[model samples]
Target: MGKAAKKGIFLTTSRFSHEAEDYVKGLDAKIILIDGERLAELMVEYNVGVDPVATYEIKKIDSDYFL
Candidate 1:
């Protein structure tokens, strides 16, 4: 099988225990663990299930305009 078929993604609203993490380390298949905090960050970054309420921009006054 291809590498894609040998990989797994495990997501949890909570975190995995240290033992669980160590167990996967020795496994042949690649596994990605995504916990609560990281899951929220990913959602925001990808705009998966989030909405932007507002946007802001900062501006600097041009000194040349005054001259």
Candidate 2:
């Protein structure tokens, strides 16, 4: 078969596992982390739009990088 499409989700900085549980429910997606606060802060870090979704929190997901 051809290459499978990849999907993903993201975590807002300052957010622990407790708050992230809701959005991380049954769906499967990659978690992109917002490393810091303020638009200028995250903007210098990531190359994506950092808006309301980029709240002050964080979440984690598994990956093959460890294996």
Candidate 3:
């Protein structure tokens, strides 16, 4: 783990639980735990191993628009 950390290999797993998260938080190495949902979201966000077929524009509500 120390060697991997020194080499800048960021470890990530989707099987992290609350206890595991707490344990990893105490480690000196860089580790990221992406749960199932977040992993899916990231895959979609980065287009990893998947192709995006459509795009959408999202708009936020502006208070000034009503004023």
Candidate 4:
């Protein structure tokens, strides 16, 4: 647990009990909890499983355009 103070802790689960949350919060370590839904979101956000099929770009003006 003391090591958490240095490296922190991350817990990913489908659900968390109030008691568990309270216990971790009471610890001096920095604890992060990510539920199943959030874990999935993070995976998608980071492109964990999906493949990059295509790319697109939008035209925008640069400072030179103004100049």
Name the best candidate (by TM-score).
1
| Model 2 quality (TM-score) | 0.23
**How far does residue 66 in candidate 3 sit from its true spot (Å)?**
18
TM-score per candidate, chains pooled: 0.76, 0.23, 0.55, 0.58
lDDT of each: 0.90, 0.52, 0.71, 0.74
For model 4, residues 1-67, the per-residue Cα lDDT tens digits are: 6333544546565778888889877876667877778888887789987787898998877988787
lDDT of 4: 0.74
Q: Count the backbone clashes (under 3 Å) in each candidate.
A: 0, 8, 0, 0
Q: Candidate 3 versus the native: TM-score?
A: 0.55
Off by over 4 Å in 3: 2-15, 55-67
Q: Kindly list the per-residue Cα lDDT of model 3 for residues 27-67, writing each as its tens digit.
A: 87766667777777788889887897898999999999899
lDDT (tens digit, per residue) of candidate 1 on 1-67 = 2645678999998999999899878888888999999999999999989999999999999999999
User: Which candidate, 1 or 4, has the higher TM-score?
Assistant: 1
Candidate 2 on 1-67: residue-level lDDT in tens?
Answer: 0344355545455554655655545445544444336445757568566445454667687677677
Deviating ranges (above 4 Å) for candidate 2: 1-6, 11-17, 21-28, 35-39, 45-67
What is the alpha-carbon lDDT for the whole of candidate 2? Answer: 0.52
Better of 1 and 3 by TM-score: 1
> Sorted by TM-score, highest first, which candidate order results?
1, 4, 3, 2
